[model samples]
Target: MSLQTWLVSLFLLICVILCWSVSAQAFAPYPYDSYYSGARFRRGPLMGFDGEDTQLQQLMQNLKPRPTLLIRIASSLGCIAHIHMATAGEIVEVNWLAEHINDPHVKVLDATYEVKPKPNWEEFKNTSYGKFDELIKTHVNPNYTAEHIPNAVHFNLDVAYFPGQYERFSFYSPELFEQYVQKLGINKDDKLIVYSRGPAAGMLFAARVWWTFKVYGHRNIEVLNGGFNAWKSSGHPTESGDKSATQGNWKAGPIDKSLYANFDDLTNDPRGGNLFENKMSAINMLDARPGGQFNGSEPLGFPAPKATGSHIAGAKNVPLPNVVGETGVKDKSALEEALKKAGFDASKSTVTMCNSGVQASMLALGLARLGIKARVYNGSMSELALRASEYINSK
Candidate 1:
């Protein structure tokens, strides 16, 4: 055959191979499909993900680190809010929520944070720098003292997300996150809803609580759209003062760190090897903040030390859009396509991180629909800003 003919044939052959590969992957079995329809929403790479081995690993492993203490807070069998999505949720919102805002078992907690002037400087401590607006102005609960929604308890987000310069922000060890949850009279079995001021910060905060419950195997959680602002806009009442209630033996479950990404984990591990690189095809990162913040050009919050770094090492930048009428993460086809070209397979792993973890939640939700195995790093820019030198010296 002539050279020209051979070249044409080779190109066609490559096309045929590509088509077959994608077809085979499409037909691959999904055992979880028996339960999770949401799985279909993912947009993963056909070439990279090795779910079969991982799935088998899941089956072969019967070992649970803290099986003895774990409880399913929301189960298909139990969690009230989860079971009655429309009806019970409505009734609970009306009859139970307002009256029980002061309930011993239901605690409506607010997890808020403020950025420090320097990345490593701690916040919410005894300092002139710890103003609430600098933490996250949009999600503040000003109404909590005025007339808090019923069946709620108030706690500073610091109770869970306290940060230190020497270490990644300290989380309420599973034990700590759990104890605080239970101290508010919350349990594995109660219906729970977490709200924020706007969807980004609030959703991120709510995701932390939701993740805490889920990692402990508690599933009955929902994030209120638009947080306290939405609540008040909807005419809900807010109250003031910290309300404490009876506690329960809310045991901590095995720490499932798999659902979240840690700064150290992203920086060192092979799974997160692509973390700081811009080649999306390597499964790097996606920033959820406005472009300026991610680019290290804008001040993170009014009182926050200006953001530094070119975002999470190597991740591509895609500012969350101001979707009309929708405040949460919106479906953006263009952004999704960009991610695909960059090697960010929704079926594979990606860590959504922001200054304080709240904005990342918006990115996580958007990625979730695309079938990406995404986890929130939980620390926002503050995590890096506080520890700027560590990243600066290395990169």
Candidate 2:
């Protein structure tokens, strides 16, 4: 054959091979070797193609990659950057609150409530720091005066509800909430920072108070991230006495319906209440109850007439301990991972429910840190068990 013809044939063959290889890489299932392939595309190699080709790179830049699992779940779930920016004012770190503790307009509150089985006081008697009887009466029972942040008032969740409400810790009526905070000397304009004793349940309790304040239309409210433990561990000053203050005019603002969810919302939900089986729900109904309780293997252990062992029909168990870690709410990545592991769809709206709405608030707080706004089912499993027993799912 002639030299010119042979050269043209060889060049055409090489070009065809290159095109085929590019097509295969571009369409192959993305491996983890390079960032351009898997979840988010970076416009470089298709699947770890080491060689740089301007045509291939430009083609990739124009090609749309498949959305990540989380992105496919929901675009409204928000991203990590959005999460960090959004979480700034909702929770105060220990140092920030310490610096502002003395500010007059800032009101710090110890919203501590015990949800565990009663501790045997006799065991702590000898190892106690001071007079055993006095300690048990004042400190052990959270209802009374106790050690707290300096200038911080005690917010007793036990009696925060209206007289005729379902039970203790049921959401308070607007008028009753107004009277409750007024008695604590909180004014409408006060910038409230609520904290609790433990990182898990305590933080949840504090979040519940924060949620309540938000529900009543209090604009300037936040939770102390790590609560009392964070404060004490950081060497922040704490006093062992009740805070005394004259009443300030705190009126209940119009209720913010968006933050609170009722039983009917659950029944009307599109998730159809069983993410555990179907895994394709428009709403992520999270049950913050422990695994045993969720599966009906363990009792709720509370005296309330609430159903002990079951969850709302469409809920997935995420548990309180998983939501709140040793350092308050888990970091955004960790929380997202935990929720994802529980079959959470990042793009869907979330409604959190627990035994008494406590852990739900905790999960809400964690979701808040992730920049995902979630509603709390204030009439949580307690109301569900009593009113909508049909929706309760037992293993």
Candidate 3:
């Protein structure tokens, strides 16, 4: 062979070796036994060249890539990078989930909790539990059983792991949260992609699931942008029937307090004087409800009893519809514009609340996309409406 051809071959070989090394490093298990994307391989026999590494064997068996030199190289470099950065952002594109849908390391969850309030809601104003019961039968259950993203697990958030004696919107206890996660077959290091279809084809309930994961110290999770509607619109695949997952060994870590705010934190904090009355204060309280509900012009939302259209007197109304676009959560630039138009003060500490905790999480997710972290009031207005008379009168 000519000397020039020989040199070219040497350069190509070096690139291949470097790419392989990077791929292995990208997949290697992190310290503290964390996961990188979903590739949590044991540290042994470089990429399992020894042929006895069970993890490597499983990986190879699971991924039946085309047997071509170029394909192998591309798979190593391109595909590994894709997996490595799968959960890097708060949002993942439909195309990315489509490409990695079959990877064992990637877990997709459908967190759809469709809310259907009655047309004449005042008749059942005091029966929030009945509304929830009705939605489970008519909306949430049927939607998941009828169609969902291929291989997506159903994350039943409303009542499955709920505490028995709290107001209906309470966060699950740490133990119950752990049990729920493990049952979903989630691993500590798994790349979780959560999606939901809103009443009008927007992304809604998934943000609460993402927030719950973050609250329990799991960071490798992303919301599927545009949600199930986006997947269908793009002509990706779907599954009609429910499927079971092998239970995962996933355990909950210590709660991350910064991501959560309880009722006491909102009511008693020295920095907060804004929950009961409209005032300029240290914290920015953004209510993710429509102007009508926030200002007492419309009927109460899903489960807020007694207080039809009543909100914390201090909250600036930043509706969920404004925070999320027609498809999903707005893109970064659009989100920033919306927040600005809604008079969101980025400098102040933010606490988001809606009727329940659901819409608040969507606002929190939008703030997160803009690199601003905000707390979700787990109790939200339901808790507030139930007990507001106690605090509102005292304050």
Candidate 4:
């Protein structure tokens, strides 16, 4: 072949390969026909060609790459980012939160609380320090109140509790929530950031507050990634003694009942209902307790149960540690995998419960990160065992 002919052939081959590669990347899966249809082709020439050759070459060169594979996959599966969860860095990224700390529109809440078995004051005293103390002070004395993140207001988880009842902890009523809103000086449109002590302790407390805000129609809210533990570990400044927030006008909106689950929802009836027999296929129950508790072995120091053995019938045990690690809730992919392995169905409704409904919020928070709306059973096993006679060992 002549040298000129050989050069021309090589140029055409290169163009063909480029065009093929571009085409392959642009084609997305089903239900995106509109995406493909709306894509436009640019008119231009390739290798300085003209007329028919120019037209063909232009078509090849004009083929643009489509949205990235991640975007396409997200679109195909109808994936959405959950706005309710935030990482430690995300809150502090570029000093975003630091800059806004003094802003009237930004409010930070410390939702730390002490959770120990009932009738065990010693256990409560032992468990309340460390992460819990750093986030918020549950008790006050002349010596000191608990330390907390700077400029953070307090939201006592105790307000959500009602002891000696079938359902010990219930969602705070609108009137009570309004009192909180007024006390915290938060507006409906304000950006609220809540944090706890750790994944096992304060994180769940933070999640419960996050859930409460959501139930009351507060959309502008986020949970701190690793709570106060992560904040202190990062060497952020802290303050001791109680800090009062400026009073502001904040009102409660309509309640979103879907964010919470009561004892009746988890059982067939008020008295000794069988969880498995009454189970709704649409709703999956997830127990966020340790394996021992899930398998019917009560942990030492836990209150003697009115009825004990196993988790609620039909409950899937997904330990809190599996979803949250030393740093924080595991990355999104890891959390999704953990849930799937535990037989969680993203398409179905999920109800998370733990010993006293504290750790369960961590699991719910993890699910929320993946854009799954999970309802928290506030009373959880503590109330369930007392109210229901039936318990089954999943082991």
| Candidate-wise lDDT, in order | 0.51, 0.67, 0.69, 0.63
Task: Rank candidates, lDDT, best first.
Answer: 3, 2, 4, 1
lDDT of 3 by residue, 1-395 (tens): 97756975676566568766655443334431233335544543224234334555455444444234554576456534544464278988999999999999999999887554313233333443333334334434678879999889888776433422324445556676676677668887798999988742456788888998899888889998888889999999798887677888887877677888877777666765444553536677788877887676675544434443365545677787777777777667787777787688878888888776788888898889888888888777666655663332211
Candidate 1, residues 1-395: lDDT per residue as tens digits?
Answer: 97756975675556555545443433334543344333433334332224444453353244233212122211111323322443231112233445555544455655433433333344434452333334433334454544555556655565444555533345556665666566666666676766544446345555556555655666455555455555666566665654556775666677666657666766666754534432334555666677776565664553334333445556655455631124443445654665665456455557676666656655665564454556677665666655443342111
Say which candidate scores most in lDDT.
3
Worst 10 residues of 2 by lDDT: 72-81
Task: Give the winner by TM-score: 1 or 2.
Answer: 2
CA lDDT for candidate 3: 0.69
C-alpha displacement of 113 in model 2, angstroms? 1.8
lDDT of 4 by residue, 1-395 (tens): 97756975675555455544443443423233443343444423222233443444344444334445554444322211211122222222214555676787778888876664453434433553223333234443221136887888777665433343545455546765576567666776687888877446347678778777777887677777777777777677788877766776777876675877776666653333545555545467898988877776655233435444566556788898888777667777798788888888766677888877677777887887777788888777677566653443344
Candidate 3 has a TM-score of 0.70
Backbone clashes (count) for model 1? 41
Stretch of 10 with least lDDT, candidate 4: 79-88
Which candidate, 1 or 2, has the higher lDDT?
2
Candidate 2 lDDT tens digits, 142-223: 4425578888887765446421133225555577567768877898878899998754835868988888887888867888
Q: Over 4 Å off in model 2, which ranges?
A: 1-88, 116-144, 163-168, 199-201, 268-282, 300-309
Candidate 3's C-alpha runs over 4 A off are 1-87, 116-140, 160-166, 273-280, 301-309, 390-395
- Winner on lDDT (2 vs 4): 2
In model 4, what lDDT does residue 123 have? Answer: 40
